[model samples]
Target: MTVTVESRPTGHPGYSQTLPREPESAAIARKLVRTALAAWYLEDLVEDAETVITELVSNAVDHARLESIRVVVTRPTEKLVRFGVVDRSRNVPYMRTDSNGDNTRGRGLLLVDALTDRWGTDRYRWGKQVWGEMKCD
Candidate 1:
């Protein structure tokens, strides 16, 4: 996967990092979300944000056949922070309901969509970015 460092916000402080596309990276992603929220304006919702980020990153790493992952945290203002993960797979993430009593899988996007204030995906040339915004106010 291609890792690119985009310019930070002109005034708002934020962070971006490249991580290996693996399940282990989920823990690191959670930490990154917690740190970003603490450093930005979403401290009150850091726990929820961390949980959402961890699930999304874990799903991407486990499902998307990508070599690397890119995570970006940006505070567009003081009320909200956006956390996103971009991978190198073209498959779009989806949320599915489990009806066969199987609880071992297929709930990441559902949890993310249910938890975040707003979330969506943007398609890239080679992959897509699944992003969510958590509100602090």
Candidate 2:
């Protein structure tokens, strides 16, 4: 995946890192989210944010046939925390409800959309980013 480090105009304190696109990377992504949140003293957001991160990273590892994927964490302000997963796959992430309620899969985006205050995707020339925000206030 082509990842550019150029920061946008959000002006928030944030972090971004790339990892091999594999099942193991999901655990690493969770660890990164936990560590980053701890460093920022945003323990309140840890549980939910980690869950969201894991879902996003796992989806990338499962679907995106890329060398690597990127995870980004940022706080636009003290009241909100944002995270995104970037992958080279052009497929857009969307929430879906399965008719079979017992289905374990296909619920990743559903949980993400349900938990986050707001979530969406941003497409670039090479890929797209699935992002969500958790409100701290």
Candidate 3:
């Protein structure tokens, strides 16, 4: 895994890591999120951010065709932080409306929706990025 810190126009540094698209990569992504939040003194958002990243990474690992995916952590503002997973697959993620009480799968996005202030997907020519944002204050 290679981690890189880049300066964003918002004056906050964004951290990203490219990791193999495997279930184990979710742990690494969570650690990256924790480290970045610690450095920014946004520790309060750590738990939700970690959960959001894990779900995003898990979805990518299961559905994306690429061998690798990118995990991104960015502070869009002093009071908000965003977590994103970028994959080569253009398929967008959505919450399954057909999920029932006994179903174990397809609930990740529901958890993400409940935890995040807002979440959405950004489509690009190459792929799509699924992201969730939480408020710090």
Q: Pick the candidate with the highest lDDT.
A: 3
lDDT of 1 by residue, 1-137 (tens): 99996532322457778899888888888788787766554577877888888887887888677688988787766566788898888888877776548566777788888888889898988888899987665
Alpha-carbon deviation at 11 in model 1, angstroms: 6.3
Task: Report the Cα lDDT for candidate 1.
Answer: 0.78
- Model 3: lDDT equals 0.88
Worst 10 residues of 1 by lDDT: 5-14
Clashes of each: 0, 0, 0
C-alpha displacement of 72 in model 3, angstroms?
Answer: 0.1
lDDT winner between 1 and 3, please give it.
Answer: 3
The runs of at least 3 residues in candidate 3 whose Cα sits more than 4 Å from the true structure, single-residue gaps closed, are 1-12
RMSD of 3: 7.2
> Which candidate order results from sorting by lDDT in descending order?
3, 2, 1
Instruction: After the best TM-score superposition of candidate 1, give how far the Cα of residue 107 lies from its true spot, in angstroms.
Output: 0.5
Score candidate 2 by TM-score against the native: 0.84
Q: What is the Cα-based TM-score of model 1?
A: 0.83
Over 4 Å off, model 1: 1-13
lDDT of 2 by residue, 43-128 (tens): 87888898899899988988886789999988787677788999999999767766567778878988898789998899999999
Please say which candidate is ahead in lDDT: 1 or 2: 2
Root-mean-square deviation per candidate:
8.7, 8.7, 7.2
